[model samples]
Target chain A: MKHYQAWCFDLDGTVYRGETAIPEAVRLIGQLRDSGSRIFFITNNSALTPQMQAEKLMRMGIRAAPEEIMTSSIATAGYLAGQYGRMDVTMIGEEGLREALEEAGHRIVTEGGEAVVVGIDRQISYDKLAAACLAVSAGAPFIATNGDLAFPDERGLVPGNGAFAGLIGSVTGVQPVVIGKPESHMIAEIARKQGLRKDGMILVGDNYETDIKAGLRFGIDTLHVDTGVTRKEALAGHSEQPTYSLRSLSEWEI
Target chain B: MKHYQAWCFDLDGTVYRGETAIPEAVRLIGQLRDSGSRIFFITNNSALTPQMQAEKLMRMGIRAAPEEIMTSSIATAGYLAGQYGRMDVTMIGEEGLREALEEAGHRIVTEGGEAVVVGIDRQISYDKLAAACLAVSAGAPFIATNGDLAFPDERGLVPGNGAFAGLIGSVTGVQPVVIGKPESHMIAEIARKQGLRKDGMILVGDNYETDIKAGLRFGIDTLHVDTGVTRKEALAGHSEQPTYSLRSLSEWEI
Candidate 1:
């Protein structure tokens, strides 16, 4: 066994976004694979299913098994279902939200929908907003995927999970229950399932607020890769700074 | 008869959180005092700032203003602000957001702390959270003054302006320009100076968001009555809300 035991890498910003892969990062993953290191890919984007994510990884030249990939969406589903016990969910989002709820045995309904599930729906319309507001106002427990205000795309930043949550909150006059990374339960489960303590574990990612801030609670070591969502200026004045800051993941050793 | 045609008001939820009457929301003042119509009192609190808002009729008893109160805070502050001058503003959150900006001044600064002469301070905080965050991160204009978030007694939900705007948002990011009723420029100047707007008017009182929402752009109307900080949930679903929401003052027409 290697002295450095396990390595967990964040996929979206660390490995790839859409089809683009970080030049230096590709080499690091390949080297790690060749070195026989146990790797788990984590992501905040919960839009797709794990199977799809795994496939995307392979296409990017980073070979990933389905089990190797973990997503905030997946964690969210498990958390909600485990806590509420299979509920009736009303979705104003995409497949990831629906898949998570359904997989948890929660019945999905709309227009007279009982429980509320809010997430990023780029295709969201005013009608969906109306339905969601109505459901939440009618006393359905509201759940949000994440609180990311904007998702920076190739073409500047656009509305993300937080914007959608804001709409629901504005209408129902209530904020939703968030179930993604940075929050404990999901990360705790990730640690437990991987048979590791949050401390001593290495969390590599791109974003600062969500990825890095979430790592703060676990006392885990974090390495931030630039050229992704987080800029160089954002890395200043922190009570908890990333243990290591790398231009890319190709510098990984052990 | 003058070229002035619009009336604006701001007071508690308008200018100062609870010191002076909202200057922008004093529309009925000009109508009853100076003789003008087409009244609009823009406010931030959609909950109850406008509807329950009334002019001071007597000591213990209050009187009616109108059903023309506008709440931009509830409208998300995006609507009216986009209409007039500079799109971006340094907001302290009054009359939604923009109406206050347009009514008081077109351009807003997130960095020039003292240049604008004044602005409201919501949710002020400690360390880099309040002053530094605004100056460093959001480039906010400046700190207006010590605005209270909650009021004395009432025992309900006592969230003061300092809690939401000052604490959370300042801690998170950005400082906004406040265009609400009681901001001295909007309220006091009405008495000192006149003939600048389409209408000449006067507004006063306690709350900040509502009293300031309907500043002089559309028509002058204001008066912020002391409703404590728990006034948010007071007017959640009111239809045909107030043109003037006040807590005291036996001078204005009821």
Candidate 2:
């Protein structure tokens, strides 16, 4: 029942699932925009660029600018830039992660570097993993875009970036610094970049583990909708409860 | 030291490190062969076939027949053969694993098989991993050739087959049945194939964790050398010690 200055929404299960957009979520987002609330689309997908995500949202009748999207790739780049400034980075990811890192003034290399950043790479090879292991074992800072082990596809659940990062961690005996929920790096990046206070921001998502936990960790209010991953019945299992839990975004009044 | 009917030697570190053979080990193995002891080369490297391993040993002055070499690939195949007879297998590995599985009467497939077998594959791709993850998530049995997380290469320690298997495991929440040194499957295979009793077998290696532990778990005598991993000083940390520890193979009397 409280109005927030910024409404951060998780993209995958909150706004859309695969190719189709949730009508209730789309309608709610439009109402929030009309009410003069800042909208941010946050996602753990490091494969697609902000422009690509915005285009997808536009096709679903949701107006979103590239600057309004905060993907894990962008958050990873921003986190690295803030932590160590611009330096050589060994990267294992798709075009989005590469572009984000390069845009942040970090040089990508094949082997030794100041940091080893990993994301979901569909074209992942053994050589790339070997190089990452070697670099991480050599004491380079290891960073992962997200820690999702498996994600759903048309066929079934498939290996995600977190699985690959876990492999590297097992081999090198080093843990990577994760940049996605529920670590709160992306939420912090959004707050810092937009000059918004955590008290004035509310994260709305369907997943309790990633989205809701992220908001709680970042000291922001969370609204959980039972449209995706976590069902309404599963909320009782978690010790920490979200600020608001609704069956759908349609139940929320602007 | 008592003479045994069978002498099982671990390939890397015990007999040879990289390309060079340990002179003391080579001399002792020759003496053991002359003394009419059955010699077996046991290795967790699933990349190389038994014939290739035998040839490598032969070139190092240790005469070994293909039947005398028991690789993790061969052990895995043998294990699968005994457990399920002949079944369609989804494989993610190199030539050795493929050959061994096929030779054991199992048909290799890309996905949706009775089981999923993984090994050290330098040509590993994300698609292959995705397929394996899907298969395992679909309720197929997951098997790994070895569980060595990292192995030393020319540059440094690189990700091993276990790392990739662990990745798939993380994605599917399935623990792979490892057929390698620490598990005693390879040693069990040698004993079953040769009709040798556990009392008549003695495992020789430098690594206490894998080699010695395999021998101990298999109820056989174990000889640990200090020429490779698990230094003599470090052996004190382990609760279960090897049957015998020596500075070199030259210390053993024929």
The model with the greatest DockQ is: 2
Candidate 2: tens digits of C-alpha lDDT, residues B1-254: 79799999998899998788999998998899999998999999898888888888878776789988899999999999999889899898888898899999999987788999999989888889999989888888889999989888889988899998999999888999999989999999999988999899999999888999999999999999999988999999999998899999999998
Poorly placed runs, candidate 1 (over 4 Å):
A1-5, A111-114, A137-139, A170-173, A184-186, A194-200, A226-236, B1-254
The DockQ-derived docking category for candidate 2 is high
C-alpha lDDT of candidate 1 relative to the true structure: 0.53
TM-score of 2: 0.97
**How accurate locally is residue B147 in candidate 1, as Cα lDDT from 0 to 100?**
35
Question: Model 1, range B29-135, lDDT digits (tens) per residue?
Answer: 44444554434444434234333444421121322353445443322232222334233444444333334445444554553332221222232222212233344
TM-score (chain A only) for the predictions, listed in order: 0.87, 0.98
Query: Model 2 chain A: which ten-residue window has the lowest total lDDT?
Result: A11-20
Give DockQ per model, in order: 0.05, 0.88
